[model samples]
Target: MNIFDRSKHIYLSPDFEEIIKDTIRFFNGTPVHSISIAERFHGTGVYAIYSIAKTGIYSKFHLVNRTAFHIPIYIGKAVPKGWRQARQGLSENTRSYELNNRIREHSRSINLGEGLDIGDFFCRFMILEGKEGDLIGTVEAALIRKYQPIWNTLIDGFGNHDPGKGRYEQAKSDWDVCHPGRSWADKCQGVPANQEVLLQSIENFMAGLNSEEDA
Candidate 1:
């Protein structure tokens, strides 16, 4: 019997791994800017949002990212519109400024949050184009896997949009419960998450990060 089974496994070449590493390095080297400033740029790519808010449950998060933004509270990607439908080709409107628009939307969300201040948020983004644009989702997945950001992993719905008419049957997102100001989220008829439980989750997550660093 053959010891190695090549038929059942997929191989990942070292070069392929290097490409992902290089892409991550490029993204990390991009300048960090305030969310307002970041929303002015035009391109489709991935971004990381860091919080420096010292409010109640977020103070620990602020301390970790205050000096250098090594930790991101949220990581997300913005792809060109219709890219999903086209799958293989670029959209006809390549200059749609999807990345900028997405960041602008986030700014609006933060502004609406009762406890979140727009001034405490910052972001870093890489505007990938041409062949590199195809790697946008890949890069975003890699970052989220590496950091396991609070918004991306633990607490969800930071990236959600209002489900239009008659679609409010689902439970309200943990994020909506904690932040509590997006008008449409109020209409969600299902059970809402306990804010205390979400805060405890955030506390535990921060503790785990501390343990990892101490190790």
Candidate 2:
């Protein structure tokens, strides 16, 4: 069954986290299709990344292929940087336009890496119209906490930016350790986790999820 279909059970409690789950559930109803990085997305919102089972180490995830889109591997939020400031009449800026840029950055990183194909990834996003503070952040945190995507947890740095000079001396991120393609990451001095460890981590995470579902 489609995961979206499974999400029809509405939460009776009015917790803020339920809003995040509900938003994701709404997008899960959209048709699953791959999008080009060149495509532009606007507004403040949350997004989810999907992958085919045949793609790179994601094959190990063994995401059940019952839906048009595979299981969500990552979830994120984007908020217009100046939305709050604009309200205070401090600045006129409205759109951060960083949402698509962030996704494209991920695509570029994936394309440059060995054994990973940017083409295997697809995404679904929903725009949240109103917010000044960390509303998007709350939703993002909720989704990540519920899903526990490996990119968000075990292999961090999917949201990383260039640390600039002097900082390159810092150890590489677990993301770089596993995927290894970002040019800046190469300069960072760090020992990456071996493939065996990486795979084991993924396996354990999946097993835990399965155990929870069974219980």
Top TM-score prediction, candidate number: 1
Model 2 RMSD in angstroms: 9.6
Question: In model 2, which runs have C-alpha deviations exceeding 4 angstroms?
Answer: 1-18, 31-35, 60-63, 82-94, 132-134, 190-196, 203-215
On a 0 to 1 TM-score scale, where does candidate 2 land against the true structure?
0.74
Candidate 2, pairs of clashing residues? none
Which pairs of residues collide in model 1?
none
Candidate 2 lDDT, 19-124, residue by residue in tens: 6667668766755546355557666677777766565456634444333554577777766765556553223454555567667766777787666777777777
Separately for all candidates shown, the number of backbone clashes (residues 3 or more apart, or on different chains) is 0, 0
**Any idea what lDDT model 2 has?**
0.66
lDDT of 1: 0.84
lDDT of 1 by residue, 78-149 (tens): 997667886634455655678998888898998998778899999999988778888989999999998899
